[model samples]
Target chain A: DAGITQSPRYKITETGRQVTLMCHQTWSHSYMFWYRQDLGHGLRLIYYSAAADITDKGEVPDGYVVSRSKTENFPLTLESATRSQTSVYFCASSESLWSSGSPLHFGNGTRLTVT
Target chain B: GIQVEQSPPDLILQEGANSTLRCNFSDSVNNLQWFHQNPWGQLINLFYIPSGTKQNGRLSATTVATERYSLLYISSSQTTDSGVYFCAGALYNQGGKLIFGQGTELSVKP
Candidate 1:
C-alpha cells in the first residue's frame, strides 16, 4: 500500500486486441517509467514520464503507449497486441529528476502474453 | 545511446561463498544502479552508486565513472540470493533513461 503496485500480474490476449497494464504508486513520485524484459534483451525502457502530462519515449517505444494523468499512476497501453510484444513488463518510480542518489522502486511486474 | 555490458552471464555457487559481478559501459554515465531480482520476480534496489564504493549488509558496490565500469560484490551468499542481478546506467543528458545490461543469473545452493 505504501509502494508501487502493478495490476493483472499475468495477462493473455489475442493478436489485434488492445491491452493495458496498470501501475500505481502511493509515494507520488515525480518520475515514472515502463520497461519490458525479455530473455536475451534484458530490460528495455518503453516510456517514462517526468511529471503529470509530460512523457517521453525510451529505448523501445515502438508499439507501446504510456500516459500519466496523475502523479500516482502511469499506465502503458498496447494498441494492438502482437506475439512479439510478449514479455514481462515492469513499472518503476523515482522521487525526483536530480541525481540525489535515489533508487528506482520497482513493482512485481506484469507478465503479458500475446497469442 | 549508451551500451551496457555485464560479465559472467550465469553463475552458480554454494551457500556462504562470495561472488563478484561486473558492469561495463560504453560511454560516460551520470547515474548507475544495481538491482537484485529475486526468484519471485521482484526487482529490489541494491545500490545507487554512481561513483566510489558503498557497502550495505553483505553487499557492496563500486563504480568508477572514469573507467566506465561498476562492480557488485555479494558476501556469504544465501539461497535467497538466487536470482538475476542487473546494472543500469543513465547518461548525463539522456533525461534519466536507464539502459540495462543483460544481467547475471546467480544461483546459490544450500
Candidate 2:
C-alpha cells in the first residue's frame, strides 16, 4: 500500500512478556513516531526517529525501545510489558521535521492489552 | 517542554450544526497540526497550519502563532465528524517532539 501500516492490529500478552509493534511506511519518510493513547491522555509520544539509525525519546519513553534501521520502517519494542502499557499504539510518519509543511500520516493503530 | 490545552473536553451536536474547537499552547511553536481520530481509531491529519488559515471541505483551521492558540471549525457537522479532535505543537528548539492536547471529543447525532 502507499500509506503507513501497523501490524497485529490487536495483541494480548501477559505482563512481563516482550511485545514488538511494527510500523512500515511506503513514503519513505525521514521522521517516524510512536504514540500511546489512553482515556484522559489524548496521545503521548513514546519515541521518534529522525532518520535511519537516529532516534530519540519523547514524553513517555520508559520501558519502551525503538529502532529505525531503514527509512521505511520503525519498530517499537516493550521489553517487559506491564498492565500500565495496555493502550492503543499509533505509528505516524512525516516527510521531514515539521518545518516544511509536513503533516504526520498515522496508521490505523495497534491495540495492545497486557494482563 | 510546551504544554497544550484544549477546550470543551466533550461535545455533542445535532447534524447540520456547526462547532468550533480551540487549542492553547504555553510557548512558541514552530509546528502546529490538527488531527481527527475516527471512531475506528485512525488519526487523520486535518491541517498543518503553523500559522494562517487553511480549509478543506467542511473543515477549516486557523493558527495564530502570535496568540499561542489555534481554532478548528467544523461547518455543517455530519455523523462522520464524530471523533476526537487533537491539536499538537512542537517547540522551536525541540527535535520534532510533538505535545498533544487533551483533545475535544465530538459526537454528531442525526
Candidate 3:
C-alpha cells in the first residue's frame, strides 16, 4: 500500500509482557505520531517524532515508548504492559505543521488487550 | 493544552436525512480538520478547514477560527455514513499535535 500501515491489527498479552506496535508510512513524512483511543478520552497522543532520532512525549506517555530511527518507520513499545494500557492504537503521519497539501493521515489502528 | 468539545455525542438518523455536527475549541488554532472513523476502524480525513467553508460530495464543513468553532454538515445521509465523526484542532505553535474532540457517533438506518 502507498499509505501508512500498522502491524498486529489485534493483540492479546499478559499484564507483565512487553508489546511493540509497528507503524510504517510510505510518504516519508517528517512527522509521525502514536495515539491511544479510549472510550471517554478520545484520541490522546502518547509520543511523536519530528524526524529521525528526534522524539517527544505527548499528553499520555507513561507506559509507552516510541522511536523514529527511520523516517519511514515509527514503532511504539510498552515496557511492561498494564491492564490500563489496553486500547486501540493509531499511527499517523504528516509532512509538516499546517503545511499545504500535507494533511495528517492515520492507520486503521491496532486493538490491544492487556490481561 | 487546548480543549475541544463536540455536541450531541450521539446521533441517529434515517437514510436521506440531513444532519449538522458542531465542534468548539477553547483556544486559537492554526488548523482544524474533520475525520470519519468507519466501523472498520479506519480514520478517513474529510476536510481540512481552518477557516472558511469547504465541500466534498455530500459532506461540507465550515470553520470560523475567530469564533473558535466549526461545523460539519452531512446531506442526504446513507447507511454507509454510519461512523464516528471527529473534529480536531491544531494549536498555533504546538508542532502539529492534534487535539481531538470526544467525537459524535452517528448511526444511519435504512
Clashes of each: 0, 0, 0
What's the true lDDT of residue B100 in model 1?
A: 91
lDDT of 3 by residue, A7-109 (tens): 9899999999999999999998998989999988888989988899999888899988888889999999999999999999999998875854777899989
Model 3 agreement with the true structure over B1-110: per-residue lDDT tens digits: 78999988999999999999999999878978899999988899898888899999999999988899999999999999999999988885776577789999999999
What lDDT would candidate 1 get against the real structure?
0.92
**DockQ value for model 2:** 0.77
- Per-residue CA lDDT of model 2 for A43-66, tens digit only, reads 999998889999999999999999
Which predicted model would earn the best lDDT? 2
Which of the CAPRI classes, incorrect, acceptable, medium or high, describes model 1? medium
Per-prediction DockQ, in order?
0.74, 0.77, 0.66
- Model 2 chain B TM at 0.98
Q: Rank the candidates by lDDT, best first.
A: 2, 1, 3
What is the per-residue lDDT of model 2 for residues B2-110, given as tens digits with 9 covering 90 to 100? 9999999999999999999999999878899999989988888899898999999999999999999999999999999999999999976898798899999999999
> What's the CA error at residue B19 for candidate 2, in Å?
1.1
Q: List the residue pairs that clash in candidate 2.
A: none
Q: What stretches of model 1 exceed 4 Å from their correct place?
A: none
